[model samples]
Target: LEKAGIEIDRKVLADIASADPTAFKAIADKARAALA
Candidate 1:
């Protein structure tokens, strides 16, 4: 997805985490610390 022209916000990813943490971790692990 990164290779494409796509982007995701930290909070949006965190919201996904609220539902399925594992998926969130996989998607936004790069921004985990900031999101916290």
Candidate 2:
């Protein structure tokens, strides 16, 4: 996950942590696939 362009920086991590898990996972999944 970190290997991709996704940034696990403080802000992004906080947003993801506070966000709905399912929704966040879905978005992350799509983004990872797109990157692939």
Candidate 3:
């Protein structure tokens, strides 16, 4: 994400990645939107 210039809390992201894939996708979509 850093390479994309999006900064998120690592632990929170990890939790989302492991426990809440829906949220992880949401976050990734949001980040992609931000980049666009």
| Clash totals for all candidate models | 0, 0, 0
Model 2 lDDT-worst window of ten: 1-10
TM for every model, in the order presented, reads: 0.42, 0.49, 0.69
Count clashing residue pairs in model 3: 0
The number of the candidate with the highest TM-score is 3
Q: Candidate 1 — which pairs collide?
A: none
Candidate 3 Cα misplacement greater than 4 A, ranges:
1-7
Best by lDDT: 3
Candidate 3 C-alpha error for residue 11, in Å:
1.1
lDDT of each: 0.63, 0.70, 0.83
lDDT of 3 at 3: 53
Ranking by lDDT: 3, 2, 1
Expressed as tens digits, the lDDT of each residue in 1-36 for candidate 3 is: 665676788987998899989989988987887778
Error of 3 at 6 (Å): 8.0
Question: Residue by residue across 1-36, what tens digits does model 2's lDDT show?
Answer: 465666567677668757777767776786688688
RMSD of each: 6.3, 3.7, 2.9
